[model samples]
Target: MKTVSIRNPGMSWDIAANILVPPGFDEGKRYPAVISNHPIGSCKEQTAGNVYGAALATAGFVVIVPDASFQGGSGGEPRWLEDPEQRVRDYRDVVDYAQSLPFVDPERIGMLGICGGGGYSIKATIIDKRIKALVSITGVNFGRLMREGFSNFDPLGALEGMAAQRTAENGGAKEDINIFVPGSVEEAKAAGIKDIDVLGATDYYRNRCPAEGAGTRMLVSHAAPAVAWDAFAFAETLLTQPLMVVFGDKPGGFGAYRDGMEIYGRAASKDKELVVIEGWSHYDLYDNAVPTGIALDRLVPFFKRHLSDMPAGSATNPAEANH
Candidate 1:
C-alpha cells in the first residue's frame, strides 16, 4: 500500500489515504474498488488498511483506506473534532477520489466502515448513490451513543460542560479534551470497572495495536454536534443500496450490536443481510484474528457479488482465489 493525498474541496484540505491494489494490478483494466474507513480515534493503518484493506485487495479488488479529516494524517484544524457531518462528507470525498482513478470502476465502488465509520458510511450511502454496496462491522451510531451515554453518563450534563469548555476556549483557555479510553485493564480491574467495551478498547488501543497519530482523544466540544447527529436519519427511504451489517453477539457500552440490528431492520435495501458472529465482543472484531477471519469470509464475497462483474479469467469465488 502506498500513501496518497486527496483534496477535500468542501473542507479545502487534503485527506491522507493509503491505496492498496491487487497483485498484478494493471491500469489498463478497470477494477472494482472499496473504500475502507477506520473507527473514530484511529488511523488508516490500524484495522481499516492493515487488516480489511489488505485482505480486500488480495481478494481481487482495489481498496483505499483514508484517515478522516481532522485526525490521523488528514488535514484539518482543532484536531480530534468528531463532527459527524464532516465524517460523512469524508466518505463522499473519498468516493470522489476513487471515481477519479483511471483503474477504478466508478459504478462498482463499495464501502467498508468499521465502528464509527460504519455509522458515517450508512449516512453517506443514504445520499451518495455512487456507493453500490456497504459492509458495516460493529457499527456504532455516535449520536445515539452520546445522547444515551454509557456507564450512566449524563448527556445533558456533558453538553453543559462542553458549552462551558467552548466558552473558555474562546476566552483563550487551553482546549479541553476527553480521553477515549481512560485506563488500562489492570487499572479498570482494580477500580472494579466491568464494561466489556471499555476493557476491550483499552487493551486494543493501548496494548494490541497502538499507532502514531491514533491516540484515544477527542475535543470535548465535539459532543455538541455528535449528540445531535444520527447516522441513520432516513434509512427507510434513502438507503437502497446492497447492505451487509456484521456484529458480534456480545453486548457492550458502545452499542454497536444494537446499531447493527437497528440498521439491518431499518434499511430499505432488499439485498441486505445481518451477520452475527457468536461469542465475540464488539472490540473482538477489530483485530482479533479468529473473528476478523470470519468477517472477511463474508465480506470478500459480499463485495465481489455486489460491486461489479469480475474480470474474464479471475476466480469466481474469493476463497478459491490465491492471494
Candidate 2:
C-alpha cells in the first residue's frame, strides 16, 4: 500500500489517495483496478474505504481509495462543503488518473462505493462509461433523504427548513453547523437517539475508525445543492454497467436499504444483482467484520466476472500483501 496524489484535470484540484497493489503486482502487465469510495464526510483512511481497498488488493486487483475534493488531504476551498455534482466528478477524476497508469487495464476498471459515496457512484456511472462494473453498499440518495425525511416524517417541513437555510446563507451569514458525533456511550444514549446509525456510528468513529477527518459536522448551506441533486434520477436508462447493490435486509433505524433496492430495480443493466445481508443493521455493514466480510465475499466474484479478459498470469508479484 502506498499513498499517492493525482491532479483532477477537469476540476484542477489535487486528490490524495491510498493505492493498494496486488501481492504479486507486475508493472509491465495490465491488471483490473477498483476505485473504493468512502462515505460522505469521510476520508480515505475511514472504515469502509480502507477495508474495501485492502480486501480487493488481496483479491488480486489494484485498489485506490481517494479523499474527495475539499475534504481531508484533497485540495478545495470552503472546506466540508457537500456538492453532489462535484462529488460525482471526483469519481470520474479518479478514473481518469487510474486509466493513465501503465499497470491498470483501463477497460476492466470497477468501482465500490459505501454509504453516501455509493449514491455519488450511481450518478457518476450513469454518465461515465469508463467504469465497467460497480458495487454500492448501504447507498443513500441524499436528495430524497433531504426532501422526504429519512423516515418520511414531513416533507414540507424539511423543504421549508432548507429554504430558510439558503436564505440565511444568501444574507452573508455563514451556515457552519456541526452535526454532533456522539463521543461516548452515555452521550449517545442521553441524546435520546433511537436511530441505530447514530449509535453504531458513535462507536465506530469514537473507537475503531482511524480517520481524523471523519466527523458529522457539515456546511448547512450545502442543502442548496443537495436538495436539487438526485443520485438515481438519470440512472434508470443511462446506467448500463454491471452493478451489484448490497445492503442489510432489515432497516434497523436507517432507510437506505430501500433506496438501494430501488436503484437495483431502476438500473438498465442486464448484469445486476442485489444482495441482502439479513439481520444486519445499515451501519453494521460500514465496519463490522462479519457483515463487511459477507459484502466482500459477494463483491469479489462480481468484479471478477464483470472485469474480464485479463492477460494470463497477472498476479505474480510475490511481495507480501499489506492491509
Best by lDDT: 1
Tens-place lDDT per residue, model 2, 1-323, is 88888887756678889899999789888788999988876789885457888889999899989888888888886777777898888889889888777787777789989888899888989999878899999988877775655315665665577678778878997775656466775688997876777677677777667467775556665555776679998677899999999999768444678898899999999989999998897778888899999999999999998885544333333121100
Q: Whole-model lDDT for model 2 versus the true structure?
A: 0.80
lDDT of 1 at 293: 98
**lDDT (C-alpha, whole model) for all candidates:** 0.88, 0.80
Off by over 4 Å in 2: 10-12, 150-175, 310-323
Q: lDDT, candidate 2, residue 288?
A: 83
Q: What lDDT tens digits, residue by residue, belong to model 1 across residues 168-211?
A: 99999999888888568898778887999989988988889999
Clashing pairs in 1: none
TM-scores, in order shown?
Answer: 0.94, 0.89
**Model 2 TM-score, all chains together:** 0.89
Off by over 4 Å in 1: 150-153, 310-323
